[model samples]
Target chain A: MLKLLTFVKNCKEGVLRATPKKPRETRRKKILQTALEILPQRGFDGITLESIADALGYTKPAIYYYFKNKDDLVCSLVTDYLKDAHQAICAITDGNGSPKERLIRIIHFYVDRNCEQRGYFTIDHHLGGVLRKMPHTAEADNLRKLSLEIPSRLIKLINEGIQLGEFRDEDPAVLGSLIFSLLGGVLTHMEMPSLASLGVEGLKQRVCDFALKGIVV
Target chain B: MLKLLTFVKNCKEGVLRATPKKPRETRRKKILQTALEILPQRGFDGITLESIADALGYTKPAIYYYFKNKDDLVCSLVTDYLKDAHQAICAITDGNGSPKERLIRIIHFYVDRNCEQRGYFTIDHHLGGVLRKMPHTAEADNLRKLSLEIPSRLIKLINEGIQLGEFRDEDPAVLGSLIFSLLGGVLTHMEMPSLASLGVEGLKQRVCDFALKGIVV
Candidate 1:
């Protein structure tokens, strides 16, 4: 009975510790959310650990425990995004479909993701300026590679489409860049009330249709 | 004989003053050119009076004599471009031609100008980030108005096209934005060697074709 009681007490303690750990995870998520909110307005240099902590009703030490500093925090935020984007791109590109279908799906995925993460992109636009200044840093270099990969993946898709004779015989590299540019231009306009009025699906369809007509066989 | 000598001396003085003024004008142009060269690489904050002076082999006070300050220099550069853009837009919008033709001409003008001024757009991209931060400043507000006018002019042209039954019955505002987005996307790509390899006329033709197909009935 004594052995059984000791085992039961240990199990209960483990469960109690697990419960508190989840709240810390929740707090970390909340910190990232608050950081995203401030980034679009103030940019990277403008944000500080204290500002994030103050927004979350926590102390600076509390944030430091979660994120080493602003650089680590921003790296976490950006890498997390890039990971998700890479996964989405892979799923769409690797899926079984015609080149046209795959290309359309890729565009849709980008449009949908941007729409879903509307405010996050505003932060990204601000972060771009910060990144350009520190282009030689490892994190900035990684970001550049990731950004270039997006267009490169599209180029592959376009090349596949061309070989399959689904798309017109245009330079895949140029077309990929053009599509990337189109997506970027539309996303920038999304912040405008007039364009946002088109809503998500409506705008996606328009963009896809425009892109399709440009290169469809 | 005294009257003749006085006339000759006055003519000599006038010629000497004119000769110095020509060099002053040339120097002012050189300063603007050097500033444009540095802007794309360094952004607005990264640039300083000392840096511009260093690039041009002049003293800061010399630069100050040409431009009151950094803000004055940038304002002058941007306003000069805007002034030229405004005049070109007005000529295209008000000139006699089919709405479709006028629109294509405008797109070509923009593409050509951007291709011709490739490095300049890089500076513009950086300036955009700076403007976003101080969006309510007088210069920023003026830039906002000028930017809006570009799209607004397109909307008018599209409206006329729809009335003439040249374009499909779509929202003129939406179509204008779409064209604007397409133009923006293509202009950005003009700087990349891969895209610039498409050459000015080739890239302009592709942009025109894509835009025309999107709206043509």
Candidate 2:
């Protein structure tokens, strides 16, 4: 009991010193979360630091402490979300399984992510507009690279599947683009009235079955 | 000599009545053509009556004579473009051919049309924003219906293919959505730096092969 108490006390001291209570980190996260929630409803241009602070019951200065402006806030939001997505992909791809299984897993992962991240994909066109307007910015370049990473990972998985004899021999680049396109369509059209009638599983099944059929040996 | 004169007279009369030299129609077409040309470069919002007039070498009043306002002008442009698309689809689907062959033809036609109509798909997001903002307009409703009609036709073609035993047994509605999504992706991505490298034929082949493989038994 004495040793347990010491250990706990030491842990508390270490956490306090090494990972101090960075309210700014928490504040920044809160700001990003609020912005993301507001993005689909209000759009990138519509979101202001004032709006974010109002949502958080904080002053506009409080948000300024974390972000220089709206553009900065958006850049952080995009880069963070994409980083999380990249991490999710790595988690799925790094696990023990056949390459074919990993590919399907990645597909399902993306579909599920798209559904969960409704505001992300729904505002894709809006995002494209934003990217185009700010093409020379480092943030824009990062966003572009992160977006390309998805298909890049997909191509790698396809190449792995082909080498393992788990899938038909085909051009990974072309196949990857096709798969990416299909998922992009799914992202946009999932909310269409006709497609919405398919329900989520029915919609996912169609994408999965069709994608798998295209390359299944 | 008498027969030739009569034929020439008939031809002149036919041309006079058939086309009627309606300056209004010609002006309307010119405005829409200019708008289509400028939309990608300047976007819908960037376009103004003054710009259209400047492009066509007409006074802004002349444009307003044909189109009551900018919204009216855009509505007409969308409706006219979609009508042309619908006609193109009809010309293909109405022709006598196996369902599979017709499907391939439709795919190529859409790809060809997309390549020819670069600015159209690129501005799709901008158009969506405009449509959402002006939802109650008849032109918006018509545009929505015309857009839906493409996928509806795709479903019909897929159904015919199944009935003809050319395609594997599957849900035509879902399959149609998948195809539409794939095509949408292809359209948007065709000009991406990576995809642009695919060239037009290379991109079309990827879309065609993947789509056919997905449905073909």
Candidate 3:
């Protein structure tokens, strides 16, 4: 009876701790989502801090509390996106097989997962423009560095496959670019309104199939 | 005296014919060159025909003399660029080779030629937004269709490769997308001022090296 009472009290305390944190997370996520959709249309050069806050019906002070400045807000949005994307890229070759098998798995993972995280790509679209035109603070550089790491992992795996003689001997760097081009092409068409109506899954599958043809022996 | 008179008459006629035509062609070429540079930075919505004419100290009417409208000017500028790009693409295939060799040649031609055509890419930047927001006019539709053809050719090559037992069988459409994405990843990086300083040739070489590893047998 004494232990049961302690367990009940602990469970109630846990709920109290989780409830406040959940809404804060929810609010931050909501801000990121809205920012992604709006900024791409107006462009980062054209967007203002007040505009973002007003669009969300939040006070300037509230946003100021989350992000010290507009740049901070933009960097945080992209950094969060890259971390998620980086994970998905690593997930591509997690299965076991010949190097060829591993690469095929990676291609599907890249396509299907990118299909799910389509929103993440807009962050990349704006990333170069922002970094090039805007000043490079630590946050901007960090975001840029983290973003490139996504492809670096895929390169690492292909390098490994080459060492194992699974892939044909060639410049690993060039192969990575060819594959990267393939991904860009697929994404471009997928995003087009003319092409988007074909359905995301169908397009994703086609992209995966294309990626495999180029890499598989 | 008669021979001297005849020589002067012939010279006068030749000078009259050459003078007007040469300046007209020179002015038209000058306008096109300035438009390519300015259009990329200001965007189609941001720039005006007046601005283009002013850049060269030509009258707005002079620009009109060469071009019927903004649409006509844009189309005329792109027509030559598209013709060159199409020729470069055609040069990629060897008529007969292993699937891998043919694909590699195609990849090589693209990277080499695309590097040279960075100026042309700038013109296409604002087009995505224009196409999305505007109705499907013939000019817009034509550009859109032309854009898709590059990848379609790549897809066809992949299909041929599979049929020849030179490549692992895979969907041609998907292969087209992957190569394009790989190209985009490289091209996007080149737009960065800091990285643009790295020179497109270097970037293309590295990106192509990395991409080939993932795709080549």
Best by TM-score: 1
Mind giving the per-residue lDDT tens digits that candidate 3 earns over A1-217? 9988887987877654446567778887887777876765566666666877889999988778667888778777767877877776666555567666666666566556556655455666665566665567776667678777776777778788789876656656556655655665566557654346547666655555555555555
Which candidate would rank higher by DockQ, 1 or 3? 1
Predictions' DockQ, in order = 0.48, 0.49, 0.25
What tier of docking accuracy does candidate 1 attain? acceptable
Ten residues in sequence with the least summed lDDT for candidate 2 chain B: B119-128
Where is model 1 more than 4 Å wrong at Cα? A1-21, A122-148, B1-23, B122-147
Q: Per-residue lDDT for A1-217 in model 1, tens only?
A: 9988887987877654446578878888899888877876666667898999888889899899899888788877877776677778878888889878888898888788777765466544544554565548777798767866766777888999999898889899877767767777788777666578889898989888877877888
Q: On a 0 to 100 scale, what is the lDDT of residue B64 in model 2? A: 83
lDDT of 1 by residue, B107-211 (tens): 888887766665467654544564555447777798767856766887898999999999878889888777777778677656666678888888888888878
TM-score of each predicted structure versus truth: 0.80, 0.79, 0.64
lDDT of 3 at A214: 51
Better of 1 and 2 by DockQ: 2
**Candidates by lDDT, descending order:** 1, 2, 3
Q: What would the per-residue lDDT of candidate 2 be over residues B1-217, giving only the tens digit for each residue?
A: 9988987997877653446468657767777888888777677767898998998898988778778998788777666767877888888788889887888788888788778866566445455566666667666787887767866787888899899888888778877777878888878777666577788787777778888888888
Better of 1 and 3 by TM-score: 1
Interface RMSD of 3: 5.5
Clashes of 1: 0
Error of 2 at A104 (Å): 1.0
